[model samples]
Target: MKLATYNVNGVNGRLDVLLRWLDEASPDVVCLQELKTPDARFPLKEIEKAGYGAVWQGQKSWNGVAILGRGRKPILTRRSLPGDPDDLHSRYIEAAVEGMVIGCLYLPNGNPSPGPKFDYKLEWFERLARHAAELLALDVPVVLAGDYNVIPTALDVYKPERWAEDALFRTEVRDAYKQIVDQGWTDAIRRLNPDARIYTFWDYVRNAYGRDAGLRLDHLLLSPSVAGRLRSAGVDRHVRGWQHTSDHAPVWVELSDD
Candidate 1:
């Protein structure tokens, strides 16, 4: 089975691009982030027509997340991250598909470091870390996939020095990610292509896509059991060049059948 994660930027605004890609790539399951629309405006008909049954949490003009299963319905598990009942951003959605638990998340961007937004980012990361640990303890196969909005190392971004002050590349954020991975989850893409500079997102401004200037923000982390099933992992970089496409491309991993 192939499981993929993509930050669609805006599901409503780019439905056409999303449909077209779905037809071409045909991932068995997909975790989508940044729907940028409300639940009522999610275009369920369009997505269902493309052969995916989905469970989504959406917000207006900003964060949202969804999980889609091809030829099947994703059994809803949780719609919001734990330990943040007061937090209202639509950034997380979880489900069960094909015997595996899938958690889709859109971590806060936390732009402009040394500020409240950055503080919130760190807080959110900590919450995620705790939840991730709980998930790991379950000992059931899980795929944590989505736009983490973090660059774990200099190798993840094209210009390390330029992003030093950026929240995504800051030491604190990277360390949080490391803490989660250290809980025994495997970073699929990095495990598959250890020495390559693989990336999933490009800035909309500055012709970043054209220049192949991008960041490896989207990730698929497999629990130890699921990691053992990993067959291949890759980014559909060419998809980012499509007209009206998202700034982020699709990243997927193929796993052996159970």
Candidate 2:
């Protein structure tokens, strides 16, 4: 199956670009982030018309997440992350699709280090790690996919030195990412193309895409059982060049049928 993840940035604003990509790519399962719309305005009609049934958790003008299953309804598993009840951001959603447990997330973009936001970012990562360990214990075919908002390593960003002080590239953030991956999850893209300078996101500023100044912030991490099925993985880089498109391009992995 072709399983993909995309941070739409704004579901309604970029509806056209999304639909176009859906038609062109036709992934069997999709994990979407940054819907940036409230639940009431999720545009279910438009998405259904495009031949995919979806389950989404949305928030107005900010973080949101969803999972789409082609020709089938995604069985809703969980709507929010488990660690906090007061944390009311729509950053995560999970579902069962095509015999796999799919977790879609939009991790916090903690800017301005040495502050509350950055602390929250680390807190959230730890919560996610705790929950991820639970999922690993289940030993099912699981895929945790989304816009992680983390430049995992110096190799992931265009200029490591320039982003040294940035929250996304900070040492703490990268270490958190590593701890999660160390918990028996495979970084699908990196596993396949270890030496390649692959990127899944580019800023819509200063001709970043043109200059190839990008970051691999979006990721699809697979469990051991599913990792063995990983046949191929790639980024739809050209889609980022589309007019009025999101800063993030789609990232995907093709898994062999069980």
Candidate 3:
């Protein structure tokens, strides 16, 4: 099966580009983030018409997550991140598609570092770690896929020095991500293309795309059971050049059948 993750920025604004990519890539499952639309306005019909069914957690004009699959509709497993009952950001949504448990996440951007947002990011990471541990204990095939909003290492970012002060590239964020990977989950992209400077997101400002200045923020972390099936992984970089496209390109991994 082929699984992909993409931060579409805004579903409504980038609908056309999204549909085009879906048709061209035809991944078996896709985890989406940054829908930026309310549940009622999700354009479900449009997506269904493209030969996929989705389960989404959405809010107005901000963070949201969804998972789409070609055949059966995914069974929604969890909508909230478990620890914080009051946290209402539509950042996480987990579902069962086929035999795999997939988590689509839009981790907090936490900009303007050394502030409350940054603290929340760390706190959120802790919650995710707990949830991930629970899933790992189950030993079920699970794939955590989406815009983690983190740069795992210097190799994952272009001009690491320039992003050292940024929340996405800060040491704390990277360490948090490292902690998760240390839990025995496999980073699919890195596993396949370790030395390649593959990037999934580029800032809109400063002509980042034109200069190929980008970051590997979007990812797919597979549990050991699922990691054994890993076949190929890559970035759909051309999609980033589309008209009115999101700053993020799609990242995907192929796995053998169970």
When superposed on Cα atoms, how far off is each prediction in RMSD?
0.6, 0.6, 0.7
30-121: candidate 1 lDDT, tens digit per residue: 99999999999998898899999999999999999999999998999999999978999998899999999999999999988989999999
Compared with the true structure, all predictions reach lDDT values of 0.95, 0.95, 0.95
Q: For residues 175-215, what per-residue lDDT tens digits would candidate 2 score against the true structure?
A: 99999999999999999999899999999889999999999
TM per prediction:
0.99, 0.99, 0.99
Worst 10 residues of 1 by lDDT: 206-215
| Cand. 1 Cα-lDDT | 0.95
Q: Write the per-residue lDDT of candidate 3 for residues 2-65, one digit (tens) a residue.
A: 9999999999899999999999999999999999999999978999999999999999999999
Any idea how many clashes model 1 has? 0
Clash total of candidate 3: 0
- The most accurate candidate by lDDT is 2
Q: Higher lDDT: candidate 2 or 3?
A: 2
lDDT of 3 at 212: 96
Query: Model 3 clash pairs?
Result: none
Question: Candidate 3 overall Cα lDDT vs. reference?
Answer: 0.95
**How many residue pairs in model 2 have overlapping backbones?**
0
